[model samples]
Target: MLTILVTGATGNVGQEVIRLLLNQNCQVRAAVRNPDTATEILSVHPTAGFSDHSIDRVPFNFTNPATFATAFQGVDKLFLVRPPNLANVRKQIAPALEAAKRAGVKQVVFLSILGADRNPILPHSKIESYINRLGIPATFLRASFFMQNLNTTHKEEIKTRGELVLPAGHGRTSFIDVRDIAAVAVRTLMEDGHSHKAYTLTGGEALTYYEVADIFTAVLGKPIHYTNLSVWNFIKQMRDRGLPMDFITVMVGIYTTARLGLASHVTPDVEQLLARPPLTVRQYVEDYRQFWL
Candidate 1:
């Protein structure tokens, strides 16, 4: 029974990872900020389909060095994800990696963004460098933009304002589903021949925000529009919504990168990993149609 410690266990990706791992009867320790709340949430998660006893919950905080040792104990592999709110990798993630190293953790499968190595401006690029500096047996899952963002970050506006507003001007993105990314993470954690490898995960196709809006309209049977705003207006809207400046900056940067056509690259990695076609944007929109409605 190889034990894998999962950071950010309650997040979108982590929860899916834990669910998929448990379906395979793999031992998973969910490292969360609050074990009790996490346990409750997992038990009730619509897709989790597991009880509290199905997975282990341990207190782990990226900012707290003390919890890392305890969470990493007896863990053979680690599933690492940087919390979206935290930008300072040196102060937040470095300590945890040190603790994992000290705990003698064997391998790390990190969730990194696409083009992290080339984009030094992104924090994930710095974290990737740090992982390399540690010389740990690591695999980087460089995933494209998540399709779940439709259900999360942009959900409210879609539901209330009937529009998708962003700075991505006619830019297409390879929107991969988080579930597919989780499946790849589980395979890398459990299988062999993946160490020291970097896998770029993306959907089968690239679609622009306008195309996504059309999908939403088709699926929800209503008129949904894509409001392409200027980068300045996007920043102002996010700030007015009380989002942190760092998060807003990162969001805008990624959108700008997409607008420049850097994010439109589609890959076969997801299909190659799963031996099946990746989910399409239309399918994703149809699956979550109720949310948009």
Candidate 2:
């Protein structure tokens, strides 16, 4: 069995990847900061029904270099993701990638964002460049906007404020479920022929926030709307809510990119990878309807 080391193992996408890997009967070593917390969380996860011996936990912190080698030891492949708050790529990620290369890991599946190579300002773009510089055999999964945001960052607004607010004015995004991205990542890690290739993972359709709100309303049996706020105002609101400046800036840049209609392109890569159509926004909303209610 190939041993895969998964970073950010407790995160949404990481958890989904772990679930799928376990279902495939692959040996998974989850690199998390807190094994006890991760064990508690995974024990209750809906997809976590396998034996404890199938999934193991190891300590790995991107900001801490001391934990890298131990986590990378005996790992054949790696599933890497940059934590959203860690912007200093050179300081945090570069060393870890270097360590992975040194630890004899053969292949890496990096969770990157769509258009990462084109957007120099984004940390993911820089990380991708660094990965290439190291000459590690890797595949990049440039995933689009995640539909799980409705339950995460935007859930409060959808439930309390009765609206979805962002700076993506009149622009559509090919929002994909993180689970779909996870599935593609699993394939890339386990299957051959994907080395050094970048896959743009997206949902089946491109929909504006307005259209998304319509789906939310229909699914929840209540009225919900999309509010387009100016970028500055959005930043101010996030700042007021105590979000860090770095995170706020990153989010503004993403929404600004969408506002320019750059993130609206729909791709068939997810379907191609999974051999089935990607999940639609309506299906996602219906699946998580209780969150909005």
Best-fitting candidate, measured by TM-score?
1
Q: lDDT tens digits, residues 31-72, model 2?
A: 999998888877766445545666899988998898998999
Report lDDT per candidate: 0.89, 0.89
What is the Å distance of residue 112 in model 2 from its true position?
A: 0.5
Using Cα atoms with residue i matched to residue i, what is each candidate's TM-score against the true structure?
Answer: 0.97, 0.97
- Residue 33's lDDT within candidate 1 is 95
Candidate 1 lDDT over 36-104, as tens digits, reads 899787876646467767788999999987787789888899999999888899998998998898888
Per-residue error at 29 for model 2, in Å?
0.6
Location of the lowest summed lDDT over 10 successive residues in candidate 2: 44-53
Evaluate model 2: give its lDDT: 0.89
